[model samples]
Target: MSAQRPKILIIGGGFGGLFCARRLAKADVDVTLLDRSAGHLFQPLLYQCATGKLAIGQISRPLREEFAPYPNVKTLLGEAIVLDPDAHTVTVRRPDETEFVIDYDVLVLAAGMRQSYLGHEAFARWAPGMKTLDDALEIRQRIFTAFEIAETLPPGPERASWLTLAVAGGGPTGVELAGQIREVATKTLANEFHSIQPEEARVLLFDGGDRVLKSFAPDLTSRATQALTELGVEMHLGVHVTDVRRDGITVTPKQGGPDQQFAARTVLWTAGVEAVPFARHVAEVLGAPTDRSGRIQVEPDLTVAGHPEIFVIGDLAGREGLPGVAENAMQGGLHAATCIRRDLEGRPRRPYRYRDLGSAAYISHGHALLQLGRVRVSGYLGWLAWGLIHIAFLTGVSNRVSTVATWLASIARPGRFHRAFMLGAADRPEQRYTYSTSDLPAEGHAPGS
Candidate 1:
């Protein structure tokens, strides 16, 4: 290592971390990016993967491949268990459970948030969140398998249970998942089943808020809700889930009503997320204040209040009004890199100013919702914008090409043709397990943070 070169350690490979490493490639510093996952995921399209509109390879690229052109950048797969900003050292645990210490002159904490089951961490098994490749794969399997199971079962409570799909949280993820799931069941798998009419599947999007896509404008939210309803998704607004059972979920209407039990064999959680357990260590070690969500409170320069050399970006940073979206993470990462570069030259570090590129949710084939500041768009034009933006933002050209090809095929097919409800794994449904309510911290992230 050169004495003049600073050792920069970035603790994630999400949008923010990857871009940060790229921005620092030619800065004459060694950049080591550590993530538990092997690839950098294009998270905005994760809902597509969950709905079978895309394959894993279409939305993720190997982290090593992303930095191969830059000799100064290195990628490693490991869980960051501990962060010591004062000591300028991070303790990483490898896949084998072996721990190693790495010292850095500057540290960037882009470690993203993990899927939160609200207060019920145990609900994860019944309904997986659409965050990581594994999460999406599990959902796709569970969903398709549900149809197959429903086909085999007699027309009874069990069959009805198998046909029910519940999506918790009407945010972008839930909206996208609900809409696509409706499309798959109603349009894509229209003729794939025998005894079961896939269109009969009861798809529900339940949210505690008054409307879906609460982050978007009211008009846009209303349009998204209408789109979901037209596609046969039941939008149950102002409802809070109290318990998640293997057979279904129990919820109480937030507006005062008797508790209700919705029979859903599969439920997907898109409700909430907290920072990784690692963030708690940062806050505890630094006496930094974090909200109930456990994100770190950082200075405007994206560093801990008193720890100037330590930067927290993405979902981990508790920036006052910043949304927990990909754009904020990307901006935070780039700004942190800029600050590091400026600091290297004995200059002042610049504050991070997040720019919202807007929030969007994909609604079925030719529908979507886009919100950028005061502007709101929906319907076919919105879908085009959504498709173009996601394709353009994919990690690499290959990913983009593959996604384009995938989209083209969907256009050419009946829809979600990825599965034929074959007599394979779908023949044997996964047994339901008892979900626990213990609030355990999240282990690692699936890209977004």
Candidate 2:
């Protein structure tokens, strides 16, 4: 062999890892991109999928397909379970539990974060977080099924409980969820329901902060509050969700007041996030420091101290003034790729500098918020801008096309197209259908027949 190319191994297929790999596609180094899941998910649109506004396919694309054009990049499906810094190898566990080792000359950790239950893991069973596709599907099931269950029950507190939905968090995700739930009730299922009026559904939003969308400007938050209020989302601020149960949640006032309870059948969580477990493991193995949220602290060049070969980026990266957003991850990925290319070219690496590209949040139909430096836009104008921004950043062209088409269709129609959900084994046993065999058409007398 004339020469050996540098082997670059990247963990996670989120925005950071994927963008980094793409940036290094034409480089001489061989790259291995690995992730636990097979698809690259557009996480910002996950709430839309959960609310039946978009399909799973519209928000995610297969990673292998995404990287097929780059012959130098190889994709693998596995979870990084163990890290050995001395050996420069990472141990990964396959879906079948088989263990394998990947050795690399350069390593990039961008595994991202997961929803935090605030040290209450048990709450996950009752309140599904909007972090993954599975979580979105689970929330979809609970949301649509709750309405179906309510349609069968007589008008009473039980029906009201089934129609009541609770959302924990005042951030972008929580705001989007609360707004979508109300829209789904008032517009989508208004004419579909028979017994209980879907418009009467209750959407309760609880957050410990004094106001919603704390990350945005105060004026933008006020606009968002007005939109949500008009849409009928009950805002319960200055309260912490102390307990989450199967049928309801208990909230305690942050300023020291008596705890209160709200009965709800559907609970969605988007309060906080912590670095994924593998990121924590990598921090320990590499002797790197991490924050309380388990984000690995990186040097100015986005590399671990004393370990130039190792780079940490994205939400798992802990840096002052670096917001845990997609734009940061994308920029960090490009910077890391540039550093690698510079090393190959015998040039000195430069520090990573982040550019503030602003942030956006959707409130309801024809309402959104967009904030740039000293510039804020809300209402219909912000809504249009929000659509354009999301479409521009969405992963694939096909996904963008489909998502836009779906959105247009949703605007013209009164019902959600992707509302189907499957019942799990546990739920199947407890389900009681309202209709029987008599409700179906006779064997040879189908509607078409």
lDDT score for candidate 1 against the true structure:
0.83
Tell me the lDDT of candidate 2: 0.89
The local lDDT score (0 to 100) that residue 184 gets in candidate 1 is: 85
Judging by lDDT against the true structure, name the best candidate. Answer: 2
Q: Which tens-of-lDDT digit does each residue in 161-193 have in candidate 2?
A: 999999999999999999999999998898987
Error in Å for residue 215 of model 2: 0.6
Per-candidate Cα lDDT values, in order, are: 0.83, 0.89
Clashes of each: 1, 0
| Model 1 pairs in collision | 112-449
Per-residue CA lDDT of candidate 1, range 318-343, in tens?
97888898889888888988998887
Best by TM-score: 2
Please, what is the TM-score per model?
A: 0.92, 0.93
Q: Where in model 2 is the C-alpha error above 4 Å?
A: 1-3, 411-415, 426-449
Error of 1 at 109 (Å): 0.3
